[model samples]
Target: MGEVDPAFVQELEHRPKQGIIEAEGLPIIDLSILSSSDATPDHSQALEGLVKQVGNACRDWGFFQVINHRVSMEKREKIFNASGKFFAQPLEEKNKIRRDEKRVLGYYDAEHTKNVRDCVKKLT
Candidate 1:
């Protein structure tokens, strides 16, 4: 193919305007209840309560977080930092592990080749 034109590439990269909306929302539930020394009779009870709450949140709103879990503070902080760094990397670098290279693993943008049903089945 002939050499691509730089101006054409720049135009392709341009983004269109988006509408904005302001909305009020309720505060998230306080998770400190899971952390207190007197929170539950034992770890098993605490875990059971958390599982029920998480299941309800998943079914109702599709998202939740479990605070005061076994993951150490240092490990969680490290994971957060590492994820931020990975996301901040240049697109070229991230694309090295793009999803089509495997049935699983790496980045899969919305335009990924695999069908949604197949991907979900494989993931599950």
Candidate 2:
């Protein structure tokens, strides 16, 4: 949150930004219907429709928002807080579990776009 490195800003200036879509136009998938166990014809049809919606959303948009997922807000908040704490760690500490060719399930900081380094980080 302090002064960002000028070099980082320069890199961002040259990178293609993600397109923003209006909230109303965004794909918001409802998940409540999938929770029902009734084997009625209507339920089966609705489930099939839901599956198609998810597929289309994934194909057209890289991601889609979900609703009525049934996850409690408290659990969601805890996950967010934990992620914040993890990302807040110093670089060296994060690298202690560095992801590499030999190990595909750990921390990584560099993301490549068309083989070009794009600044990003993740722990898998």
Candidate 3:
């Protein structure tokens, strides 16, 4: 909750900061379809559009992203704020929440997933 420690900010300066080498815009799945009575059993009005986007993303790009899933920006900010506090803890303290390979759910690092590593690569 206090000001972020200066040394911690300095430490992040050493992490990777390269630009993305390859990139593609992903389709955004809107959650509004879930509540629409007009939607099909699979919750689709743009069902074919969603299917095409998802199919292309998986078959060609290997992954996709979602958007407009109904979380407000205010709620999203709170989540990020809580995340900052959790990540700010020292490794000894943070490791308590580290997830195991089998029970992976908690604060797992970037070393385990190529998908995340690739995204970081693309982002940086």
Candidate 4:
């Protein structure tokens, strides 16, 4: 909404225009075959298909949703609950894991996208 940072502008200069190229929908990848124990020819074909789908998704969209992943629903729910608990913690507690400016790891409250920046190095 304000003047975009020159560095950010430079970063976007070579990227494709937003919304210029659209895939039919968000890419979805199934991982069931890769996890199967059977090594039949059909399973091999499925695995090959899986690899191609993953590669195309990475090339076209950079990321995609996965189905039939190994993690159980219970573990997924636990992860969600833990995320909620951490996000709900007091500011002082959350700051302990503040991600520094240069690193992409740890936690933060705000995100920057397009040309907007929000500060969130600490919970407050």
Among all candidates shown, the one with the greatest lDDT = 2
- Can you give the lDDT of residue 79 in candidate 4? 83
TM-score of 3: 0.53
lDDT of 2 by residue, 30-65 (tens): 999978899999999999999999998886664688
* Residue runs of model 3 more than 4 Å from their true location after superposition: 1-26, 39-45, 62-65, 110-124
Looking at model 4, which ten-residue stretch has the lowest summed lDDT? 115-124
Is candidate 1 or 2 superior in TM-score?
2
| Tens digit of per-residue lDDT, candidate 3, span 30-122 | 555545577465555466667677787676556667666778879978987797788779988888878897767886665623323322322
Compared with the true structure, all predictions reach lDDT values of: 0.55, 0.78, 0.61, 0.75
Per-model TM values vs. the true structure: 0.47, 0.67, 0.53, 0.54
Give the TM-score ranking, best first. Answer: 2, 4, 3, 1
Q: Clashing residue pairs, candidate 3?
A: 18-124, 19-124
lDDT at 21 for candidate 2? 47
Report the candidate with higher TM-score, 3 versus 4: 4
**Residue 42 error for model 1, in Å?**
10
Predicted model with the maximum TM-score: 2
Tell how far residue 92 is off in model 2, in angstroms: 1.3
Off by over 4 Å in 1: 1-50, 111-124
Pairs with steric clashes in candidate 2: none
